[model samples]
Structures are given as structure tokens and as C-alpha cells.
Target: MVVESGGNARAGRPRAASAAQILEVAAQIADDDGLEAVSFRAIADRLGTSPMSVHRTTGGIDALRRELVAALVGDAIKAIDWPTGWREMCRTFAYALRDLLMRHPLVLEAHRQSALEAPGADDIAHRVVRALRDAGLCAEEAAYAYATLHDFVTGHVSIRLGRGDFESTTAPAERRGASVFVDHHDYDRRFETGISLLMSGIGATLAPRIRS
Candidate 1:
């Protein structure tokens, strides 16, 4: 999806770089050093241009960040071609999105902040909803199912990322302490089981409604 920005050029000179170029540089910076590391000058320096030129093309830093998030999410959505079968489709999408968001932690933050209110997000939502409808769900039922499934995936990934306290350290003493105090959960297995239950629940509910 093309990024929505203010203008294509600066005051007098024609801007040499595209929004995509600027956004990619910004996304790279954010992905490497966290989102706070990204700034207009940072992107400009990487692009070998002035900060004003970046601003002219991107509108401002906020818009630039928004576009960066959109590009990342859009790429994630495009990575998984629509799989066949309802169960396969839903599970594949959930896992794919989880993997992508996990790769770019800042994108998760941006998604939480803006909900991806762009064409990229819309496309992703539409594909999942369409899968539900294809599996005998009516419009309203599909909407609800999509909401439940999407929320589950988003929440799971968010929790996994936000659970930094429980991640990365496997020391014996710490493991013992965590086992005693934190009661660690196998999130991957938990997510798969939950996905099965969710899809089954939707099928049970939607099948009856479709029959009646």
C-alpha cells in the first residue's frame, strides 16, 4: 500500500527520495534500536539528504512513523498468501502475524497505538473476515468471529513481547525462582490450544445458525 503523506517536494527543489525510501530507513532504525531512535534527521542522514527534505516528503515525524508502521504491517500481511481451508487459514494467519510482529517490536507498539487504521490493516482484516464468511458465517457472525480471533492473536503477541521480565534468562537459580514465583507458561502451546478452541467454538456456533 502506498503511504499517505503531505507532499512530494520541498520549498524550491524537487525531493529526490520517495516516502517509501524514507519510511524504510526509519523502519530499519526503529527495528534496530527501538522506535525512539528514529527521527527525521536520522532518516535523512541515512538517505543522504537534509532533514527539511525528509519533512517535506513525510509531513512530519509522526506521519513518518505512522507510514513506517503501515509498511511493516503491510509487508507482514503480504507474506502469508491466503491459505485454503478455514482452520488452516485462521491458524496460519495468526501464526504469521505473531511471527512478523515479534520480529519488529516497534511495529507492535505502533499497531497498539494506531490500530493500523490504514489500507494495509483494512486488507488484513478483510482477508480474515472473508475466510469466516466463506465458512458458513453470515456478515455479523463473521465480524464477531474476526474480532475474537484477531483480538486473541494481537493480545497473545502483545503479552509475549510485554512479558520481558519472564523472557531470555535460563539460569538455574533464576529458573527455580521463576518456577516458584512466576509459574511460567508455555505460550506457544497455549496459543495453539486456544486457537483450536476459538475456531471450534466459532464453528459450533456458526454451523447451527447456518443450518437454522
Candidate 2:
């Protein structure tokens, strides 16, 4: 079933309600019972308001989900302490994004593609690209590097958390001997190793150009 939008609900302004409060309650519902459980009625029930009020504030579920994703990405970006070197900065960002996804996997559910266009997304992208440019990568190369790094980190986290079609827990049960390949325990180390290898490869490829 699609998300409940509360279009037919009775109209009434909720007393002293705010968009932030609505989002907070909606996120809480999602975190507790998955994204499908979040609806205008659910949020209103939690906030002691009406479904129409919630819907009016959020403009329906899709917009609310987009806002939720944007808020989360913005906050996560603000919390990062960027390091000196480009590689280190990229590594830190990868870790930070991974951690944020792990903590609030439902935010991605709120809006899977929204994070790319989310408020703080451009800021983080600029920082990464600037770092790469400073490290001697041309604009195109820096953009590619940032995009690749972002996809790797986000994709890894999605699979790790079983957020996408790839359910880590159920994958082994679906096929014979798949459990051997589905090593859930070692993802932490694997993620680190993956980042290290990626950084190494980028540095090696750029060393010749940087030296010139």
C-alpha cells in the first residue's frame, strides 16, 4: 500500500504545532515500526493534533519524507570534523555517512534519492571536490572520485543494513551455501579495507599527475 496522505481528513489547524515536531513524531513512528507505519494520522495521534493538521504542515507523505531525509543529511554533515588531507577527509566522510545510515536506516526509507538533492548534500559534495582539487585532481576527476566514493559508502551501508532489495539476513536462507558469502560479522573490517583500497588506488593514479 502507498503512504497514507490524509487527503480526506477534516481540516483544522493544530494548536501550537510545528513542522519540526511533526517530522520528529513521524520519524519516531518510522523508527519504531518501519516507514510504512508513518502516516498523518499516526503523527497527529502522537502530537495530539488532527490528520489534516499534520498533512497541512508536511504537504503529504512524500514531501514529509523528503524533508526528513534533508534534515538528517544536513545534521550529519554539520557534525563531521574534517581532517587535513584529502584522503583522510574522504575517509572520514565515508565513515560518518556509514555511521549515520547505520543509526537511522529509516531516513533513507523516507526518501531514497532525496539525500542526493537534500539541503546539505551540495555542501558536502563541494568540500570533497575541493579537497580532491587541492590534491591535484582536475574538476572532472574530482567530481568522479567524489561520486564513486559516495556510491560505495551509501551502497555498502544499504546492503549491510538490509535496507534495499538485498536483505542480508534472508539472503542466506534463500539460496544454498549463500550463508558463506553473506558474512555480516566482518563488514566493519571490510568497509575499512574497502575505503583504504579505494584511497590507495586514487592516490596511486594521481601521484604521477601531482608530481608533474
Candidate 3:
């Protein structure tokens, strides 16, 4: 059945396509080719349907891209159990986001676009902001912290992936009498140190202000 995004059912509804099916095909196209390769026509071709069918199901490429982001974010969210300490929650969440991006590298571009429009993306942002607010940050401070943390995590992943040096650059093996350090271990240690420094600074800055 032809399922248009508007949900308009004419006298002959045809078979309405499922949004999930459309998104899955679009994601496959994006992964196999790239985000630019994802179009209604491209997805339809991959799914053995006409472009109109995909457009009816997903609205357009923009809408389809946003759905892809939602799907990816949903997967990431499922990896974590929330309602814990805000700091720990956020740290784990950031790691989860990193893992998600790495798994679906092409989806990163869609994620960037979706972050500006998708309600699910905004929900994630709001969660981060709320966590900061709960940690004694004022509204403005919480907003700033959320933005900073988001940028930091996404930017770090971008660099790692862009450079194609996620392993060697992040943790190069020592030559000669090289110290006993592995890439993954180094990455974890440095990542934890950076998080600690940021949280420590935030705590110090807010302590006096909150007391005052």
C-alpha cells in the first residue's frame, strides 16, 4: 500500500509503505554509498519500489534523514540505563554516542542535520541540560555546559574518524623500550582524564557561586 507521509487515503490507497522500511533502505544506501547517495529515487531503487512510493512513506529526503537520526539515536539510548548519577549518566551517554557514530559513520551527517530539527535529538539535548541543572548549575550555566559537552564529544569523534587514526594516532605504540601501553587503554585513560578535568572545573566554579 502507498503510505504518504500526510496519511491521506484516497479511494485507492495502494499498499502504504512502512516508515521503518523506507528508513532502513535509506540507511543502507547512505552506508553503502554515502549520505549524498541517499535520495528518494536511490532508496526506492534499493527497495525495488518507485521513488514515489518512498516519498509517500518518508515525505522527502530531509524527513527520511531525520528518521535515520532518530533510529540511530534510539539505538544509542537503548545502550544505557538512565536515572543514575547525572555525571556518570552523561559520561556513559557520551561514550554510547561515540560508539553509535562509529558504527554508522555515514549517519553522522544526518545526525548533524537532524540535531537541528528532530524532536528526539532535542530530547537528548534537554536531558543533558537537565542533568547539568541538577548538578547545581544555573539555567544559563547548564545551557553552556550542555553545549560545550556536546561539541566536545562530537568534535572528538569527528577528528578520530576523519583522521582515520582512531587507533594509531590516539595511541601509538612506543618503539625500542616502549612503555607498556595499548591503544585502547590510552584512549580510555585520556578520555577519563579529560572528563575529570572538565567536571572538576565546573564543580569549582559553581561551588562558590551556589554558596553565595
Candidate 4:
């Protein structure tokens, strides 16, 4: 997505370097290629400027990668019309996050490389935990539920993108042992099933404590 750059540029000069513009180009490169393909030179080439210009505007590649993660997360979170009911809220959050990761699978790779915290991650976590609390989970349970849900969505998307441990090694015969097993093609159905099971498990295992 082309993020509109802010500020004006003088005639005959490249537009003033905006982080959003750099990230927009960078994201496209990462999506077309992979996260490793994103480089100062690549972004510069797209922006009609030198790599040094891109570096100066974004601090460095590491910083830029971190910013990219935060931007992607923040943008996706903002777009979600989060539901009020706890179960629906968790479902909505899961689907929204999964969709974002599918679109930009590189976000997970960038997140891994950065290792430093992304800015908006905490806010996203808080929203998830709040939903759990509304579901009658205690503070600790809410936190655990939030983490579990987040991991499930990200892990599901990662596997769908062929980043799973058995993606390359599972023998075809082994894969055929069970219907829907090792099958990445029908991810929507698989994901829905997984989420439904998780929601049910959470309600059955934890919601009762609150109701009791």
C-alpha cells in the first residue's frame, strides 16, 4: 500500500524523506521478494534517492524493520471493528491478525529479527486481555489466554506460509493419514476449526471458574 508522504519537496528535488514512504516501499519489496530482500538500496531505488538518504531518514535498517512491524500492527488493529462479547472479540482479533500476517508474512520475519519490542504490541495485547477479562477470566488467566490466542493465530499463519517445522519434511504418505492433516490449502476451514476449538476449550476450562 502506498502511504501518502507528508511535507512538500522543493522543485527538482526528491520529496522530503518520510518514514511512512520508506516503509511503504520497503513493505512492497519485502512482499514481492522476502524480508531479507529489503535493503536501503532497494528502497532508495524505488524512491529515486540514494541508499544513504533512506538510511538517514529511517536511522538504519534494523530501526526501519522495527518501525515496519509497529506500523503494520497499528494499522491492522485500527481497522478492526472489535466486538464486545468476549468470544466474538477473540475471534475477531484472531481473524484480523491472521489476515494481516497472511498479507505480509514478512512481518513475522521482521519481528523475529528485530527482537526489540514493537511499539504498539502492548496496546494490542491489552485489548485481547480486556476481552478475556470480560469473559470472566481472572487477570492471570486473561493474560495466558491472550498469549495463547496470539500465538495460535501467528503460528497458524506461519505454517500456512510454509514456515512450519514439518513444511518440507512430512512425507506425502504421512500427510495423507488424516483428512485436513498437513494440508495448507484449506487454511480458512482449518483456521476456523482451530479457533472454534480454542474458544470452546477456554470457555470449558476457564470460564467456569468465574461463573462458579
Candidate 5:
């Protein structure tokens, strides 16, 4: 049965499919091929429907792109089931977002020109702010910390994933030279160290003000 734009199918009409479902299919198209492949006509072809049918539900390509970004961010947030503490939660959330972006590299490109005021973005930002405040950071400190953590995680993941270097290719002697001073270590340790360094810097900067 065909889905209508309003979410509910009219009497005698096919059952209405959710925007989420449409976005999911669109996301698959984007993820598998790239965001450029996520046109209304493409989605319609994937769904075995006419381009007009998809356009009627999604409004247009721009609307579909917006919905796709929202869906991806929402999915990333949902995947983060961290522990109670603010630091732990932030770490988990950061890693989860990194993983999601790495898995869906197209999302990184899609959000390049988009504002961060989207629904899921706002919710994630609020959560980060709340977590930082709970960790004894002031609003300004929390904002800075959030930005720093996001930049580090996103930048690291983008580099790693974009280079397609999850698997090492160098020999043992070459691998040892990869680290200038320290010995070769697991990637997870490197990630944790980066997160810890950021958290420590934030704590140090805010401690004086917070204690005053």
C-alpha cells in the first residue's frame, strides 16, 4: 500500500508510511552510493513508486535532505546509552557519534552546509551542556568543552574513516615508527587518551573559577 504525506492514508487509500521510513530508505541510498544519489527519483525507484509519489510525500529534494540529516542525527543520539556520570556520558556520546559518522560518511558531507539548529542537533547540544554543568563546569566552560570534544572526535573519525585506514598496512618496523616517541598502541587507547586530555583541560580551566 502507498503512504500519504499526512502520515495517515485516506479511507480506501493505502496505509500511510512514516516519514521515518521514507528517510530510512533515503539514508540507505545516501550511505550506499552518496548523498548525490538520494534524489526523489532515486528514492522512488528504490521504493518501486513514481517520482511524483515520493515528491508528494517528501515535498522536494531539499526537504528530503533535511529529513535525512535529522534522521541520522536522531539515530546517533538514540544509539548512545551511556552510564550515569557526566564525563562518562559525554565520552560515550562522543564515541557513539564518531562511530555513527564513520559508518555513514555521507552524513558528514550532508551536514557541511547545514546549520546545527536542527531538532536532533539541539537536543544533543542541550544534553552536552547539561552534562558539562553537572560536571562542575560553568556555562561558558561547558560550551567550550562541548565544542572541543566534538571537534576532536569528528575530526579524528573523519580522518580515520575517510582515509580507509582502519586496518594497518605497514610492516612491524614501519608501524613502530608511526609514533614518534611512544610505542605503537591500540587505536582505542589513543581515542581514550584524546578524550581524557580534553576533559582534563576543561576541568583545569574551570576549576579555578568554579572554586572561587
Candidate 6:
């Protein structure tokens, strides 16, 4: 490892590691000590290279963070056993996403910033929307459902991450008084409940209208 004024400068020429190696080490640091700790300097020290090499390989630290988050979420999504049925598929996806974000809370910010990178593009959006349409919702309704489910899952993670810190932003309820809302911070139950409500509402919206 290099042990310099900035980091630990060692005696040998820094070991030549690829971008993949840099990413793997950076992920380790992030997993162990949060994303804030996974700096270029930190990754360089771990890889026994200069921060400039890490930077050139990754384009920049921000790009590295985006790539790492994208890789992780994309892989995790691929690993899920996506159910054949729409409702079940939705539930499976919701749980999988929540589990992943809970493990790596920092990735959510990167996810939002990068459009969840490529995973949020065709892969996820297509399946969910098509499933919603198959479940009897029209294109417009399917679009809304997609937006709602994505917002719900991301909102759940954000709430847990920024709960007490965001108390002042909660809206006041007449019966409940000025309460910091989070459905009692029970996301496990709330996620399932939201899915059920979404499916049920979608079904209702598809009901035939009565003649005047």
C-alpha cells in the first residue's frame, strides 16, 4: 500500500489493479463504512495505487458511485424470482428492492441521481407497466401505478433514513394533531399494505362506469 503525505506510501510501485478491482474495493469500503467513507483516497490506499489512477479509471468519484450503485441494484434485480402473476410479481419486487436499500441506504441517493442507472430504464419499467396493463389497467392507469409504486418504495427508504431529521416537514392532521407521519415507521407491513391498496385501486379504476 502507498503511504504518502496524503496516504500511506509504501516502498514498491503500486500494484496495477483494473477498474473492476477499484470498484470491488470501493464497494467493500462502502459496505463496511457507508458511501461517504468510500473516497478516491480510501480506494487508492486499499488498491495500493494513486488517487489519480482511480480517478482516471472511474472518470471521477461521482461516476464510480453511480456505476457501483447501478451494478449492485441491477444485479440484485436480476437475481429475483419474478413471479408470473402481476400482484405477486409486484410484491416480490417491492420486498427485494426494500431489502437491498435497507442494506445499502447510501445507494438510494445514487440510484435517484443516476435514474437507478440502466436498471430503472427498460428492464424494470417495462415489466411493471406491462403487468399492470395485463392486470386490467389502461395505459394511463398503468403509468400512474408505476409512478406510485416507485415513489412508495423510494419514499419508504427515505423515511427510514431521514425520519426524525425531517419531523418538521410532516403535514398536520385534524384528528391526529401535528404528527410526524410514517405509518408508525413500520415499513415491512406498510409496503405490503401499499401494494395491496395499489392493486385494489387499479382494479377499481378499471370497473365499468354506470350509465346516466
User: Which candidate gets the maximum TM-score versus the true structure?
Assistant: 4
Global Cα RMSD, each model: 6.3, 5.8, 6.9, 5.2, 6.0, 5.7
lDDT of 4 by residue, 52-78 (tens): 888999998978877777788778877
Of the two candidates 1 and 3, the one with more favorable TM-score, higher being better, is 1
Candidate 3 residue 160 C-alpha distance from true site, Å: 1.2
Reference-based lDDT, each prediction: 0.76, 0.77, 0.68, 0.77, 0.72, 0.73
Q: Pairs clashing in candidate 3? A: 1-14, 1-15, 1-16, 2-15, 2-16, 3-16
| lDDT minimum window of 10 residues, candidate 1 | 1-10
Which tens-of-lDDT digit does each residue in 1-212 have in candidate 5? Answer: 34334333333444434566678778888888888888876765555556677778888898788778777777677766757867787888788877877888777877565653345677777788888888788788788888889888878876676655534544366664665533544566778889999877877876787788
lDDT of 2 by residue, 1-212 (tens): 12334353336654545887887777777777777788887887766678887788888887887677677778888888889989999998899988887777786565474445567678888999999999989999999999899889878987876644345554456662456556544677879988999899889978998789
Error at 161, model 1, angstroms:
1.1
- For candidate 5, list the clashing residue pairs, or say none: none
Ranking by lDDT: 2, 4, 1, 6, 5, 3
Score candidate 6 by TM-score against the native.
Answer: 0.74
Ranking 1 against 4 by lDDT, winner: 4
Q: Which ten residues in a row have the lowest lDDT in candidate 6?
A: 1-10
User: Candidate 1 vs candidate 2: which has greater lDDT?
Assistant: 2
Clashes of each: 0, 0, 6, 0, 0, 8
lDDT tens digits, residue span 1-212, model 1: 43333343334464456777887778778978888788977776666667888898989888778777777777777677777877788888788877887788887777776677555677767777888888888889888888888789888888887775356354466666756435546787778888999988987977776788
Query: What are the clashing pairs of model 6?
Result: 2-8, 2-9, 3-8, 3-9, 3-10, 4-7, 4-8, 4-9
